[model samples]
Target: RANRDHAAGCVTPVISQNSLISSIAQNVLSINPFQQMINEIIKQKIAPLETRMQQLEEMVQDLQERNDCLNYKTNDLAQYQRRCAFHIYGIAENKEGNKNAIIKYIGKVMGVKVEDSDIYASHRLKQNKQGDDC
Candidate 1:
C-alpha cells in the first residue's frame, strides 16, 4: 500500500522544516540544564580528591628522599667506624703469631697497655700489593 501511494504521488504527513527545528530545540532545552548540573556536581566531587592525591604523592616522594639520605649517612658512619679500628702493618708473620702477642707488641710501640680483652677480633688479612700485616 505504501509503495502504491508513492507510485500515485500521494502526499504523506511529511514533517516541515519548522517542525524539525522545533523538535531539535525542545530536545536541547530539556537536556541542557540537567547536563550542566551534572557536570558541575562531578567537578565539585573530583576537585578535592585530585588535590588530596597530589598531596599524598608529594609526601611519598619526600619520604623516599629522606630514606635515601639516611641510607647514605648510615653507610658513611659505618665506614668511619671501621677506620677507627686498627690495622697493624709491616709486622712479621709467624705460625705461632697470636692476638695477645700482637696486641702486646702494638701496645709497647704505642706506649699503651693493650690486653686481649680490649681486642674485639683478630685476624690476618691477605697480603695486597704492599704485603702489609694486620
Candidate 2:
C-alpha cells in the first residue's frame, strides 16, 4: 500500500500513539519538581510574609486601643480640673473687676465668710449660649 501511494504520489500522514503517550508522560514528569519547588518557595517566603503582616495588624490594633485609653484619661483629667474651677453667672465685665473682691462679695452675700486664702481662683464669664449676658 505504501508503494502504491508513493507511485501515485499520495502522501500518508503517520501518527504513533506510543510517541504521543511518551511525550505526555515526559511533560507530566518534568512539571512535578517545578510545581514542588514553587510550593516550597511559597512556604518559605510568602508564608512568613503573611504571618508578619498578621502580627503587624495586631500591633496596630493594640496601639489604637492604647491611644483610645490615653484619650479617655486626658478627658477625665480635664473634667477633674474643671471640677476645682467655679463659674459665677450675671457678673458684668468691668476693667477694674478684681477677682478677690468679687469672691469676698459673693461670700458675704451668701453669708459664708469666705477668705482670700480659702478661694483658689475666680473669673467673670462671657455671654452664655442662652443669650444671658454675664
Q: Which ten residues in a row have the lowest lDDT in candidate 1?
A: 7-16
Q: Candidate 2 lDDT, tens digit per residue, 1-134?
A: 98897855533232355667889999999999999999998889988899999999999999999999999999999998888677776677788778888888988999989888887777665676889654
**What lDDT does the true structure give each of the candidates?**
0.83, 0.83
lDDT (Cα, 0-100) at 124 in candidate 2: 60
Which residue pairs of candidate 1 clash?
A: none
Where in model 2 is the C-alpha error above 4 Å?
Answer: 1-15, 92-94, 111-120, 128-134
lDDT tens per residue, model 1, 28-131: 99898989999999999999999999999999999999999999999999998797487776677888878668878879898998877877778877688664
TM-score of 1: 0.63
Return the top candidate by TM-score.
2
The local lDDT score (0 to 100) that residue 51 gets in candidate 1 is 100
